[model samples]
Target: MERGIIKIENGEIIIPDTPVWMTVGEMSDLFMVSAYGIRKALRQIFRSGIMDEHDAVRPFPYAEGCYAEAYNMEAVVAVTFRINAAACRRFRELMLRRFMEKSLDFYICIPAADCNHRTGYDAAQVWQERHKLS
Candidate 1:
């Protein structure tokens, strides 16, 4: 969603302790960021050195041991559609391999479901296909 900064109103209801927490489905709809983006951001933060045992710079926090960040529509619209889905597929491994590599101060946070990535895959099938294929 939002790439650089996230602002919250005072007393905002925090669903979870992370930067932003919405259902994986809700995020896919509201911001046009697919579940893959959410999943990627989660994995990215873990790998990006942006997180700690308590909080992550990416904003994802978990009640249990998992965490995921929230993003804004504008921030997620920058990924090249032709590669957003593929980008997710590509970076997923990097996330795991580079887990704790270093925290990224900012990311384009592109949406694979956006126009840029329109050429990459069918929008409706963002959730249908698994991202493991290379």
Candidate 2:
């Protein structure tokens, strides 16, 4: 990246952006694992509203792109406050829409990082929260 934002020296995409969300295939490629494993990890993310499904493609939730996004902690927490843990599960619901469904209506928005639109997430806090050590 000529923008001095991020580097991809070894195929490991070092993201300069935050709150990055990706599909099982992309996550598996990043993690160097199988898509099935990615799906396993995503089960929790989907339940947390940190990820969502996009029915536009089919009923398989493959369109996870249609709803997932980087959101401020306040926004997330605010939306979270309105939902219960059981409701977060993707088995029967899209956690994001149960919370911030309005974001789904947005057709155009700024990229999480520069030099490319899909390089990163919009909220560093979301990524930190997801990967943060407990």
What digit string (tens of lDDT, one per residue) describes model 1 on residues 25-114?
Answer: 454543345778665655555465544423433454546877655443322322222224544334343434455677668633435555
User: How far is each candidate from the true structure, as Cα RMSD in Å?
Assistant: 20.4, 20.3
Give per-model TM-scores. Answer: 0.26, 0.27
**Global lDDT of each model?**
0.43, 0.38
lDDT of 2 at 33: 51
Worst 10 residues of 1 by lDDT: 74-83
Clash totals in order = 11, 1
How does residue 129 of candidate 2 score in lDDT? 67
Which stretches in model 1 have alpha-carbon errors above 4 Å? 1-20, 53-134
Give lDDT tens digits, candidate 2, residues 48-120: 7754533211212335555432222233223323334332232123434445555455443434443333755
